[model samples]
Target: MANRLQHETSPYLLQHADNPVDWYPWGEEALEAARTQDKPILLSIGYAACHWCHVMERESFENPDIAALMNQHFINIKVDREERPDLDTVYMAAAQMMTGQGGWPLTIFLMPDGKPFYAGTYFPPEDRSGMPGFPRVLLAVAEAYRNRRADLERAANDIQGHLTEHFRWSLPETAITPALLNEAASGLARQFDEANGGFGGAPKFPPPMALEFLLRYRLRTGSDTALRIVELTLERMARGGIHDQVGGGFHRYAVDATWLVPHFEKMLYDNALLARLYTLTYQATGHPFYAATALDTIEYVLREMTSPDGGFYSTQDADSEGEEGKFYVWTPEELEAVLGPEQAPIVARYYGVHPGGNFEGKSILHVPEAPESVAAAFDLTIDELVEIIGPAREKLYAARAQRVWPGRDEKILTDWNGLMLRALAQAAIALGRSDLRDAAVRNATFLHTHLYRDGRLLHSYKDGEAKITGYLADYASLIAGLLALYEATFDVRWIAWARDLTDRAIADFWDNEGGAFFDTSADDAPLVARPKDAFDSATPSGNSLMAESLLRLGLLLGEDDYRQRAMTVLERFAALAAKAPTGFGQLLCAADLALAEAHEIALVGDPQVPAMAEMLAVVQQPYLPHQVVALRHPDQDGEDEVIPLLAGRTARDGQPTAYVCRNYACRQPVTTAHDLAAELGMAVE
Candidate 1:
């Protein structure tokens, strides 16, 4: 039978519709019912693509006996964390406080007013492996509520106080200098897995932001060690099973440090951040491998995760046909059947597919050897091997498509789409793909039309419905995407839109007392704590992304307040960022911008003319991460007056012109790409 979750929009909530447990979506009705009946609430929080979330649902939520116990004893509620991050933030802090650990499928027993007294993650149906069973835990909690009411209240109050305190932080008096960035670089390098590629031990997640920091560091200080770390990590990941070598995109974090095995759920944010990282690496190093990898990841998103409305979807499930990695893994016989006998052996040798298999008696294809080594083993040239492997791999991909595919979470989230938006917008210029540029333009319009309302942004969209008030990350990330689009095409309106959203973010989420941004706005529903997380986890933090956005806007628009606030954020986190820089990658990147020499570029003329196009391409190429470029078209006539960088700029004798400036002082308006490249400190043919 369907429960109350049948009517909810989140696919994660709708997944529990047929569970025997009666579930109410978190709202006033459920809170009111818990208060009126004098019963505690059993709150379960998880997302659509969480593998353990599915495991707990089948083991406990589907049990009729367990459902009966929950129905009689509590006002049971279910929440999709992606839809309501504010609630998730408040409770995640509480769960970490009580249990000393936290992950998805978060289980918490709370009082009616929403203060958590008890919290945990996944629990099995029967007690095993030193973990308590769900049934026993439920019974004991119910008993305590009735017999030891005062004890439960006391515990809740104590935990609530600490949880609130955890989110409260003070901005310190400090100075941000180049030394902080150097110290952070060393701090992050101290943990680098010299044997393996990434930073930590087991459970290796891709450190795109941290690698981005290394790239910036290389450009800033010309450190070969920084550049080597970035190159080695990217290469190792591409050769691992964590990267989908057959298809495209990367899986979730690998369970082992070798990156040989992954959890298998592919998230949009991971690919977006990785794609952008690879593109920037290519621009910085002039490497063909980085460019190829970036294109593959973007193609995967466009093929599998895009919505008809042009927004990117959220996640691809790890499990298919009730088994994790079932659809992705390949047996030796399956490979032989998919590819002919003539090609199977050669392909197997190339992808390191062995008869014993790397996973559960099935191969998760990974490149264990370089093309030169594999080609030597097969007595074929590298070009010959590539020619044969490309078509054969596509045949296998097509055959894999015939299997029962993994489930996809179809919701289009504003924050994730913004991440992908920047990737596509940047790729349009970096890769010189007109299709991606068209896609980026269309997606920007889609987001502006559907997600942005009045001056505010909405959080999630699905089936033509956009709901939920946008959070700080959503606003800041979208502003980032808009800024990228503006630079990719030199469309002034995109920058104008970004400036407007930046103002809105400041008005809504900034805290005057703390001198930083809160994760949620004051007008949003009250919780045990208003979260203001600063560390970068799976995704970049809102405060860090916003800091970069502010710095860019400050340079582009000459806004003193924006620059001042950005510097304040950098100073506030300087001490901690210098200690454990891996967790503060994005913030440190913003700090790099704060201390680096400023490059403010202005290009004036029609972009279609040969001279203008050449000059524009010169600006677009190369990394130059800290530069801010503005284009003023001759046809627009006063349309670019909003951009201070273009002020008093002219098309030198009616030809295309380029100006490279610092602190509002301009160089000669050069009319050629060579002269422009010289002004920008680059070598061009």
Candidate 2:
């Protein structure tokens, strides 16, 4: 029978609707019931895409005996972490404190007032591998709650105290400088997997933000080593099984350092950030491979992850057909059946498919042989080989489409869509692809029309419903996307919307006392703690993203407040970033922006004119991460007033012109692309 989770909007919650466990969605009623009945709360938090979450559910949550024990002793409340990150943040910290590690599905025992007394991750139905059984753990916790209430209460107090103390930051004695960037760059260089093209060992996650920082470092100092690290990592990732060679998007992460075996989940934010990273890499190196990879990744998202309303989906599950990687893995016979014998050897050779297989008796397609090697072996040029592989990949993709697919989480998250939004806009501008531009524009419009209501942004949308008050990540990331959209499409409305959102975010989420932004807005419902996460994880922290946007928006409009707030955030996190550079990737990039010579450009002309197109092309075509390009129509009003960079800018010699500025001081106006490129220290044909 369906539990109370039947009425929940979250897909993760709905997954457990028929569980034997009498689950209550986290809400006031559950808390009130717990308080009235004097029962401790059994809080289980996980996401739709988590593989172990499904494992635990199958092993324990489905057990009727375990359910009865849980229902008798505690008020069971299930939470979708993605849906309620605030609660997750507060509880996750406590979990990490109680246990030395943390991951989903996070299991915690809490008091009625929301203080967590015990915490753990997945537990088996029966004790195995030295892990305690769920039934035993439940009864033990319940018994302890009855007999040792004071001890549990003391432990809860201690955990909360540690949670409060862990996030506090002291202002660094020194301000941000080039030396800091140099140190951080050197630190990343040390940790870099020189052989494997990633950091550390097994379970290598893609550090797009760190790679982005390296790119910026290369741009700032012309450090070939920094550039090399970015290049090698991207190349290796592109050729690995983590990247679906046939399907075009990437999986969640590779479980092995070789990037061979993946966890198989595909997340929107991962693809989004990777698309932009590849696009930027293409711009930096003028490599056709990076450009093509970017296009392929974007194509995958559009084909499988986008909704009818144009908002991007959250995640595709790691498992399908009752087994992980079943849908994606292929056997030698299957490949031969799909492709004729003549092409099978060539395709298999290129993709490293052997009869023995790399992953659990099935081939996970990866490029062990370089295209040059494959081309030489096939007695063909690179172009000819690419042409053959293109159609062949399409056939494989189509064949794979017929199989049972991974379950997709259809909910749209504002921060994740924001990442995709910026990616789309950047790809469109870099590659001159109108399809990406159109998609980005459509997404921006959808966010505005459906998610943004009465001058406020909502966090998530699913099944024609938009709820949840906007978090800091939502406002900051969406604003970043809007700014990119403005640059890509030259629509001033995007800029206006971005600026308004920035101001709203500052008002709603800025921590005046802490000198950084909180993850949750103060206007939102209270949690055990108002989380102010600064270090980057799977996504950039809200504070880090806000600092980035604030720096960019500040330069574009000459806003002192924005600049000052950004500096404070940088200074606040400087000590921590100095300690662990890789974890603070986004913050380092923002700090680079703060220190780099500001390249702010103002163009006054008709955006559609050929002369303007030439000038804009010069501005768009390079790896300029620290640039702020603001375009204003010759006839537009109020833009000049709101945007100080546009004031007094005019066309030169009756032709569309560009005004290149450094630190808000302008050089002479230039009418041609060549001159504009020269002014900006760039070369153009």
Candidate 3:
């Protein structure tokens, strides 16, 4: 029989709809069942794409005997972590605190009142690999709860106290200086793996936040080392197996230092931020490879991850069937069977596939060298070589598509959408594609219309239904995307919308007394306690990005209130900024801008004027996050300074002229693209 989860909108919940074990989607029904039956709740939290989550589901949730045991003693409840990050965040923090470790397939035993007594992650069905079995742990926990009630109660009490206290911390008012940013960059450089790229050691995740910091640091201080770190990391990630050469887009992370093997899951957040970083890198260096990678990643998202309704799906699973990488990794023999003998060796050599194997006796497709090198090896022209390889890749991709695909979490999260919208808008500008920019505008509109109401933003939307009060990330990221879209299109409506959203976020999420933003709103759903997330995780913290967005928007809109609020937020969290620089690099970048000189360009003329358009293009071309530009008609007022070149300008002018200025000091008028490019510090052909 189908369980209660059959009715849920989340794909992760529906995944277990037919499980023999009666599973309830996390809701009032599950909580009521636990309370009425006087049984503990077996809370299983995992996302759709998690590899081990599938493993545990197949090994234990599917077995009849284990299902009976779970059914008898517990009210089983399932949660899609992506759909309910608030629940995931609070419990994941609790699990990490108790065991000093955390990961997916999070298992917790909670009392009827919704407080967890026991928590763990990824238990095996049978005892093996130095880990206890799920069945054994389950029996023991149930026995302890029944016979040693006082002991269980004491443990729950102690854990609850710790969980409650973790969210309570006083902010220190320390001034952030340029010296601190320099110090933080130096600290990050020491941890960077110069040989292979990326920071720290094995299992290197894409540290987009740190990369963003390095880009800004290079812009601020002209540090070659900072620029090199950004370049090297991006190049290696593009060439490594961590990137899907055939499909476009990056995997979750590399399990080793060399970036040769990856965790195989592709996440929406990772692609969004990496696309933004790659786009910025291309803008800074004008590297074709960086631009190609950024474009390919966005194309991948549009092709596979986007829903018909325009919002993006959360992730694609890491595993299909019982084995990891089964869909993506292939053996040389398989290649030989698919391709003729003559083409097999060529394809294998081009993609780093060998007789022995590159990964567990199966090859993970990677770009071993430049396409020119491969063409040279094949004794063909570059175009011909591309033609041959393209078809072969399509054949493989098509064959793999026929296999049972990994589960997808179809939940559209507001925070991830914010990240994607920013990436798409930025890419659209850098790549000069209006269609992509339109897609970003469409998604942003969808969020604003469907996911927000009554001055509050909802966190998740699925099947045309939005629920859960917004988190700080949702508002911060969405507003950031809106700002980016505004800059890309020069649309004041987006700017106005972003400003309004920012105001609401400040009123609802900001801790006026504490000086940092709370993860959840004051009157939202109750948790163990209100959380103020300051650490930069897979995405940057909401507080950090919000501070950065406010500073940028304030400069653009000429609003002192926004700028002052940003400064205050940064000042309030400076201790966290100093103590854990890498974790707070985004905040440091914002602080650097707040404490430094910001350039603003206001051109009063027709945007259609060739010279005016040229100037705008130059300004947008070079990843200048610290600069703001506005295009206005000659008659418009309220700007700090108006350029004389554009002062008498009209659309009727055969050629547009421009004025470049800093702090109300105007430069001589320039009428040509070369002079405009020179003024914006961009190279012109």
Candidate 4:
């Protein structure tokens, strides 16, 4: 029989609708069942894209015998992590605290009251490799709960106590300074893998957040080492198997230090952040490779992940059936067949396909030789060489596309959509692609119309339904994205929307007395407690990013209230930042911007003017997250002081000129890129 998940909107929940195990989607009904029956809840939390989630589902959830056992002793409840990040966050933290480790396919045994007593991840159907089998463990746990209820209760209480204690660490009162940032950079440098790039040992995830921090640090302090770290990491990641050379987007992470052997899942958030990074790198260095890579990633997202309504989907699964990377990895024989005998060897050599495979006797595409080396080997012009490789890759990609594609989680998450929208908007401004900007605007409009109600945003959208009250991250990320969109197009509508959202966010989520934001709204469906999200994990903390957004919006709108609220939030958490810099990268980025002297450039003329366009393009190139730019045309008269920094500084020079200012003090008008760059302490050429 189909479970309650059959009717759910979440792709992850729908994936398990056909499981033999009677699963209930996490809700009041499931909790009531557990309470009324006096049965413990078997809470299984995993996302649709997780590889092991598929494995565990096939191995255990599908088996009738295992299903029967689960049905008898537990009220099985399932959660899609993307849809309910609050639940994921709370339980994952608990599991990590208890087991000293955590990952998806999170299995927890919870009492009827919703407190977990036992937790684990990814147990096999049969005991093997020193791990207990799922069925055996389930029976053992059930027996213990029945016979040793007191012991189980005590364990639950103890874990709850630890959780409370962990959350009670007070923030310090020290103010952040340049020395603190430098010290953090030095610590990061010590852990950086100088040989291959990225930080620490194996299983190298692109710490794009860390790279962002380093890039900003280098800009602030002129730290060459910091720039070097970011450059090497990006270059290695681009060159290695972790990046899909033909397809354009990156895999989740390399399982090894050399950026080889990626885990093979492609996430929306990773691509979004990396695209922005590459765009910024291109701006700073004017590197064609960086710009090309950024374009490719954006293209990949547009082609594969975008919804009909224009919002990007969450992710593509890492596994097909029970095998990881089965959809992607290519055997040598398969490649030889695809290319034919004449071209097979040449193609193999160019893409690092050797007799002995680099990964599990299957080739993961990589560049064995540099483009220059490849061109020299073929005795061809660089352009001709590129032309040949391009056709070959197209042929391969076409062939690969014919195969069974990985399962895509089609749920539209507001937080992730915010990230994608920001990337698209920034790319539009940087690359001068009006089409991209239009697409971003369309997505933003879709979110506003469909996912918002009563002036509040919803967390997820699927099957024409928007559900769940917005969390702090959802509001913060969307507000940030809207601000980016506004800056990209100088659209006052977007700015006004962002301002309204910020006002709603502060009213609903702010803890005025505590001086921080709660993860969920005050009146939203209650959990065990009102959780305060402070740590920067895979995404920036809601409070930190929102704090930054509030400041930016304040500057853009000329609202002292917004700026003051931002300062209050930052001041409240300033103490915690002193103790932990690594976990607060986003917050630190905001702090750096807030502390630095920010410049605002306002261009007054026709938006279609060639000179004005060029000026805007130059400023857009370098990742100046702190600076705000506004375009005012005489055609659009009666606009408020949208460009607050250039409120009084108008067009003095006869030709198109940019008024540069610091803290409301205007310098003489500059008419050319050379003069503007010189004034801004940037290289003109």
Q: Model 1, range 407-481, lDDT digits (tens) per residue?
A: 999998999999999999888888878899878888888899999997899999987889988999998889899
Q: Over the stretch 458-489, how does candidate 2's per-residue lDDT look in tens digits?
A: 99999899989989889989999998998998
What TM-score do all the candidates reach, one by one?
A: 0.98, 0.98, 0.92, 0.95
Ranking by lDDT: 2, 1, 3, 4
- CA lDDT, every prediction? 0.89, 0.90, 0.82, 0.82
Clashes of each: 0, 0, 0, 1
Off by over 4 Å in 3: 336-339, 369-403, 633-685
Give the Å shift of residue 485 in candidate 2.
0.4
- Writing each residue's lDDT as its tens digit, candidate 3 over 246-338 gives 778889999998787999899999999999999999998888889989998999899888988789889988887767777788788888888
User: lDDT for model 4, on a 0 to 1 scale?
Assistant: 0.82
